[model samples]
Target: MTLLTIFSQSGKYLLLSIFAFLLISCSESSPPALTTTADSIYFGGTIITLNDAQPSAEAVAIKDGKIIAVGRYADIEKSHKSAETRLIDLHGKTLIPGFIDGHSHFSEVGAQTVLANLLPPPDGSVKNIADLQKTMRDFIATSPIVKKHGVAIGMNYDDSQLAEHRHPTRHDLDAISTELPIMVSHQSGHFGALNSKALEKVGITADSIAPDGGVIRREADGKTPNGVLEENAFFGVVYKMFPAFTPDEIAAQLQASEKIYLANGFTTIQDGKTTKDNLKLLMAMSEAGTLKADVVSYPDIVTFGDDPLLQSPLMSRHYKNHLRMGGVKLTLDGSPQGKTGWFTVPYFKVPEGQPETYAGYPAFSDEKLNEWILLAYKNNWQVLGHCSGDAAVEQFINAVRNAQKIYPGTNHRPVIIHGHFIRADQVPAIKELGIFVSAFPLHTFNWGDWHRESVVGPERAENISPTGWFLTQDVPFSIHSDAPVIFPDSMKLIGTAVNRTTRSGYVLGAEHRLEPLAALKAMTLSAAYQHFEEATKGSIEVGKLADFVVLAENPLTKTRANLKQIRVLETIKEGKSVYRSTEDEK
Candidate 1:
């Protein structure tokens, strides 16, 4: 009963009192227990959430094709761990939100794969008109589908890179084959050349006048059509000229096309421009369960006009088979690189047969454009207009302004596509009018020199796709590769947007170059916003779609020179793997 006994008794009493207090406090209020388990846990990699709020995460948990949690591996695992959960080891790779191309013609990707490659250097090697003819001839000889269909089709023919320094006319295509109808599309997809047979098949004659908002280039005699068609004319004839594929063939073609997009890490792809017939085919493919990624299309005004399906309630925000019609598209002019985009100034050097005082012209009159725009506005349809030149952009601004007067107080999220020639002054008008731009920045790399020397002159060329201007003016914009014009490579898009470097090692618009992280956001969050799907997609947030792409290296860490070299290892959509590279296959 000395000091040792007294100390021991006092310590035991203190421990018992503290324990009793803790038990009483726990009994008063208990925290909720974790009840839901994740279906899969991905860790051991650099996970870029692309969500500015959280920014980055060490791990992600997914359940039912949605992100359940994103944070430190230990914390997320503690809450979502279960016996049935699948553990995904990233193997030291990098993960990002699945890319959403700002603008593209995804349906045409199938045709591009099956058709002859007529693109110039970097994508294909057609250096001149002679090379183009030979490429088509070789393709026709080897393709049983072309022979069976009795039509030879080729795509991505760029005049800017051709040795002849001119567009290949129908006369040029006729050299490839007069017996079978031959059609070669300009790389821009805004113009096309058809052989005599194709012209006759479409009923174009020396006396045939071009449709409004379209042009039928004629020979020196001013009577015989040269076989080159622009803008609306391209759609009118080519839409009917190509041999129709059966439902099974279309489904197969679409699946093959989606494989290419998936391989490039595009989870949400746009067809950009579609016809009612093409929409039907897409719908059929969607219903047949052949679609591998989300598709958002904007039908051309000509194709969307007066259609019962488009006018129905189902047309607004309607989704089927992972496909949705974002809105109506209007081609205000043609391609700037193709020399048909409307401009306020004359080209430094006009095309071979053109007038000396000519500037490019618009597809349709303002009155007609306004009518179509007002129709879309009144119907609450999102309008996506292609305006490659500043003049064309002005046309869009005026049309939208007038439409707003008729249908006031609505934020419809109207968009301007390929506003490559947008100037600093026009940026204010675009923002004031509450319009968004989806610009084609790839032109800087592929045709910067040509635009400077010939298309728009050095003054205007320096400002093409002026993204810096947009940022300064606080305007919303996104960058894109008008696919099939350029390969739909997301890495290339980000690289081009960040570096603004041409193939010949020249900086086109150094001021317009975006930061690597900002460029990535353009292809993800901004692209999703352009299609009005920002809340449900774009970022790796909780309750959002589990779409992601695994990269070999982190884009933010990769040097600008090595950006394009970064390969996509895998593409995931809805928590399901849609594409795996050869490296993964091994």
Candidate 2:
């Protein structure tokens, strides 16, 4: 053969090989063809999948409440389009996975809806002591709850935000009602104040001694009950004085709470630290098909460890009628802002009536904590421990470490809820132990100044929540609202996590602030993973639940300042519109 002829043959063979390679590459990159028509197709605007494989998508198709396809709008439309399919035009809105609750008392949020709003400035109008008293009085006169329940209840009153910077005493609540039994909860829900009538009704008196892990503030004489209760002391009065709700009343509260969560773009809600009665009520509500959004209750195992109800069929991973038992909740300590969180170092400023060297105290002995955690491990149950202070965090870590040694091969996925004050050094151990942290960065905006000035001082205040540390250590963490402690405002939660801005407009923990996308993941994918629902929920992946929120602005594209202002235009759950902004109707 001639040399020119041989060269020509080789060149032709190389060209054919290149063509074959290109064809295979294109085929591999192309989206798979859809086999069935979608029940609904969402397209236009931004779709953040939170799926690493496909970080963004042009369209999503859903059928029977499960995602069927996610890819380019053209591909999805061409393959999955049908006359009966619902085409949801985003109109330039941003779609994201519906938020899952990190940790919050869902039913208590329902109860808050009925109580007088005492949260400071943004969430409510009670900014000072006078405002608190006046609000309680107004609620007494106007609220049907007061008349029906025969008691006045107010929630979210922050001593830190009050004009006087002190807890409202029985004297202050008495100003609102001398005849009526009145109680006002500190914003942390770890402390409370009761009028003389309510205190007397609850059987607390000068002779009453505080519980092991709680305090009842006393008058100057050191013997008179001042009606300001803390931790266990406050909880005891709550159980005694709070009116019993009929099943119907409890259902109404749950309905109201679910609406608030839905309006805030949360699809999965956590009713953390649930009581036996409350759990039964929730189960009844589920059976009655009254729940619209998914609720996962972690009953107070400390109180009902022996209750046969803990072994119910409802304790599975699957939801039945929008409700399921996630696991158990254990409170290891109280709130930092309330000055009750267990800490190794002394608080910047001790609470009134406390010693100068006060560093707070634990909810129970370490032995008890270890015992409970080991029990959870033995049962292979996921346990969520509320540890807001470093000392409490240490106790939890030690307990978990011991439990793991005993029950070594199981994937219990024990969680540290509200590790708000965990030390930087502890992050490594947390990562090693696989302890998921559901932090409360919302505290930064709500009480960052208070923490700096009065709680833990400037240096330590900057580390509250410490999401940045978790990120640096490669520890899995999620952010939460701990609702009823504050409103479950998802935008505010995201904004605070991103900005770490105090109410005074100062960025308290600038270094600890998360990027917008990371903050969103803490509430979505990370949160779902925390709850072991990552496989079915969290992202807009095929076979996942069709749960999403439509935002007025894309968080990824917006300036940090504008993030909190982004509105939830619509919330969809299980391929259905659960909440639509009234503005959308316009």
Candidate 3:
């Protein structure tokens, strides 16, 4: 071979060798593109994210109890699928973010589960005073709680729904038991009836004067307490009558309450107006790792504002063992349905014993209210004020306004717990004060007729919750079922907000009704915002908690009147099932 031919051949071989080496190096340096795998992937049904940026998703991938990916099913499967991944097929059902409680007494609902069901039809069978007495009699005879506690108690009886349209008097309950101490709470939770024995046990007598913010309902003579107590009068005596439970019993009650919330699709629950004892009990439970769902407590400021525990690390936005002290609760007034909600104008018809000119009264003097609100502000604690009437709302607004003037530029996010009778004029101040309203639109379904006919008259009743006003004003708000007062049925809460229908089938306020999506937002996203947990919960977004609820039917597709018929099939929290209905198995 010639020298030129040898050199040319060698050069060709060297270039070829380098090209092969480059290929090998590139293959070794860059491993196959890594695909993120997830622990679980959910698909095959409608996914309502409650996130405006992505209103819907066909699938979601979860890892380490947080959403890792959300998009088309095919896209998620391509990137997140693995042999270890558990796939969840919704089977044409609906999946949405787990419901977050707006305003409800979680611990009290446990007590309600054990108490006699005096609620009217659909929840219980009590329809009249006689029915209430019979129910109490049955409870006294059959209930293990009564057997152990040695007292008969009934819960959630609405006088408005009774055939008699009047509160069950002590005389009525005396028929159930003059021997056994008996008490029945009004559905509103603002008033209560006691048997003569119960009255004697509580030491409330004809001479017992009503406290500053409560009423002791007098008989026709206007001197003798007729066995009925209102507001603080009921508050002052009711707890005294409750038999203290053993720690195990308390734990069981709390667990039972959590079960109800889980069954209803709630991942986050509230203990509004928690007392000191209950707060301590809950803290112990949280420390013991027994609490399953997240519980945010608003301890009653009037009682526990100065408690050392309130200053502890438990008072934080983060949960320790699924529990936290969110803030403090303040009661500005009573229930409007019970005629003690502190209104600026007289009710459409005065309650039986009240004078014609009587308007409801405040729970405390304005000075005390201002002091309490300012205390919360100075300490940078969020306040949840229970204000049902416009007058009470005004009081709250004024207090908040004054507090802001003193302690400006703190994102306290004060909340109005009920705001059932908030007037149109108050919307501006509510927005300006940055007060978020957790409204009770369930009242429209439960008591619209009573409100229209007796409480506030047709005109004012038309605006009971004022959801439409809030929406129009672009003010953020939330809807709630004041459970124990009514069952925390999420469907019923959403249906009421959308339809505004009364039990009698009357559309109390068509104009005030919300859209289905808006109502859902109120329950989920907006509610989380109210609790200052929007970033971690309330939506099915990447990096958020993997909390979701599966429903038998899509609430968005249901007719407005039928939204309440949608049933929860399963509730999943932190990528694990907490509740699954046996209806499918049956």
What's the count of clashing pairs in each model shown?
Answer: 1, 0, 0
> Candidate 3 lDDT, tens digit per residue, 1-586?
7655766777888878999999999999996888789999999999999999999999999998899999999999999999999999999899999999999999899888788899999888999888888888878889988889898888899988999999988889887767889888999899999989999999998889889899898888988889989999999998988877887887788899999999999999999999887888899999999887899999998887588888999999999999999999999999988888889999999987579988899998989999999989887789999999999999999999999999878769999988998899899989988999999999988899999999999999999998999999978899888888989998888988999988889998788899999999998999999999999999999999998999988888898889999999999988989999988623
For residue 184, model 2's alpha carbon misses the true position, in angstroms, by 0.9
Using all chains and alpha carbons, the TM-scores for the candidates as numbered come to 0.93, 0.93, 0.94
Q: Write the per-residue lDDT of candidate 2 for residues 484-535, one digit (tens) a residue.
A: 8978999989998998888789898888999998999999999999999999
Which pairs of residues have clashing backbones in candidate 1? 213-363
Off by over 4 Å in 1: 1-31, 584-586
What is the per-residue lDDT of model 1 for residues 1-586, given as tens digits with 9 covering 90 to 100?
Answer: 7655766877878878999999999987987775579999889999999999999999999999999999999998899989999999998899999999888888788777788999898789899999999999899999977977888888988888999887788888888888899898988888899999999999999989888778898988998989999877787888677777776676677788889899999999988778677788888777788788998888887566867767754465646768878888888988888888888888778887779877888987999899899989887889999998889999999999999988889878899998988878788889999999998888888999998888888777888999998888878888888887889988989998898887677898889999999888889988888888788788999988899999999999999878989999999998999999987423
| Candidate that would win on TM-score | 3
Q: What TM-score would candidate 3 get against the native?
A: 0.94
**Which 10-residue span in candidate 1 carries the lowest summed lDDT?**
312-321
**Which candidate, 1 or 3, has the higher TM-score?**
3
- Go through the candidates in order and give each one's C-alpha lDDT: 0.87, 0.90, 0.91
- State residue 389's C-alpha deviation in candidate 1, in Å: 0.7
Top model number, lDDT: 3
Model 3 off-target regions past 4 Å? Answer: 1-35
- Candidate 1, residue 17: CA error in Å? 20
